[model samples]
Target: MRISLMSTTLAQGVIDWSRDGHVLTAEQKKFYEREGYIVIRNVVPQYELDRYQKRFMEICKMKGVAQSMTVMRDMTIARSEYVPGEKAIMKVQDFGDDPILFDYCKYPAIVDTVKDLIGTPNSNLLAMHTMLINKPPDSGSLTSRHPMHQDLQYFPFRPADFICCSWTAMEKITRANGCLVVVPRTHKGPLLPHEYPKWEGGVNPMYHGIQSYDPKMPRLHVEMEAGDTVFFHPLLIHGSGTNRTNGFRKAISCHYANDDLCRYVDIDKNQEFTANEILDVARKRMKKYGMSEEEAKAVQIDFADIWRLRARAVNGVRQHL
Candidate 1:
């Protein structure tokens, strides 16, 4: 997929600028508005990071070796052979079911900044998605290189500006360790066409990429230390490279939305929406649960329902039911 860049436009302001209790400085907000993303350094406490890392290992042990493949919040986890000695557990999706993971999502520094970006002091916020990614070194697959795409492609929400993502590094993230790369100001544009990347073996249908991404666009390599975080718009074009280094690169991320400001789109009738990947996952889950097509339809449970379940409220209240 290749997208051509035509012109750059400033992001349309969706923030409640009059709101108080904002933690971001004026300059930081300005930068975010201009670039569609902002990196906050050392916002996560070292102790918290360490605790979460330990908890991840503990969960891996609890899951046991026999549970090599487990699905959580749409992310797929598997044991990796790339790591020497002990096999490294690669967790790629939802961490909402875990208490420690939920704590990280509501971490004050993270949620405060999120409120500054997408909500007023009184606005309710929802933790829309969560993932704890462990990228194994030399995977030699698309698993490492996340193709550039907009997060909104999979979301069934409205008013993209009301949604944001907080991605925090659990350890030093460098280009060698597959740090994030983002196309600046891309969020100001509408969502582009998305398609599965051309890769051998089966690719996770949920992993969609922009059908057209122009290389000429202004791109940034977001390198960071442990506890550093980046809050980005849902429509921002971004992805990561391969971990060329010799160890596992780990990160925890969660998407957030102003629950009072966003609503669910009609996926079945919305011509502008492309959530085939998410729909496919819902279908598979239905089958796994022994739900026949008629039963699924009878209950009115499908991709949108699955996504709604994924959207858990971590702060204030959830407005969209």
Candidate 2:
């Protein structure tokens, strides 16, 4: 924890993230408050990780229909028959409807840490988003690099302080394998505007990134062993490197919030910019599959509506998303 102790916050009775004694130790909380993230070693056992990996592989192989799951194809390999099944996929997002995959969100080890970070000791929990990311070896196109962006940009929720993301390494993650790169303490800042980067190789669908960031900001590459889980703030500026290794890099993650304490927020003009982009993708998908324009238009979906459709109760009662 690099943050200096403050007497002013105490004077104002405004103790926010740091608390002494919980699922997270005082030291861990202090580090998270200062760095916007904390890595918990060996939180998930190897066997459990194997299950998640197997399930992801099953989805990739098209073993069964994973209802409502969006399989984002890597733009570089999307049209090539050379790369089959799993090799062509970049991410499997919104898997909350899949029971086997959703098990990752229900694991006690992850739940406790999420509850601790969200300041909800024993309350209803909602999984706002779930993803199984597969970063394949870059083919000199730099398509594997995920641009640095805040998770909050895509979320329409109030009191951003109560939400966080938990990411688990399914295998050894190193800089060579495109491990997560984080800008520490950036979570304290406001959510900046986001837009798709103009990469020579196009980005995956809905892969919006912040337009600009401090070039001088130091980036910490988070290297982790298999089964290590990390919890981070929603506003933290983070992204992954390009996978230079031949092997594909795998990781699973979920954005969590205390549903009992959270409420949907209206998207302002700036947020609508990115929101419409996401909506356009969905609209195109519907029309591509032969849905008439009038029929697709009748569907009526918004940024908040999309989240409401995805948000599911991970723990406790789900009164509202």
**RMSD vs true structure, all candidates:** 5.8, 5.1
Candidate 1, residue 141: lDDT: 56
Q: Model 2 misses residue 275 by how many Å?
A: 0.8
Tens digit per residue, CA lDDT, model 1, 118-190: 7666778888788888776754554667779988777776667778899999999999989999998888888
Cα lDDT tens digits, model 2, 1-321, are 112221122212222455663578777877887788999999889998889888887888767645568887788888777667668778999999888889999999899887777655676889999999999999889989999988888887755666789999999999999999999999888788888889898786667788886757998999999999889988899998999999989999999977766677776455787788778877877887889998888887877778888898987788767
Q: Rate the local accuracy (lDDT) of all candidates.
A: 0.73, 0.82
How high a TM-score does candidate 1 get?
Answer: 0.83
Q: Which candidate leads in lDDT?
A: 2
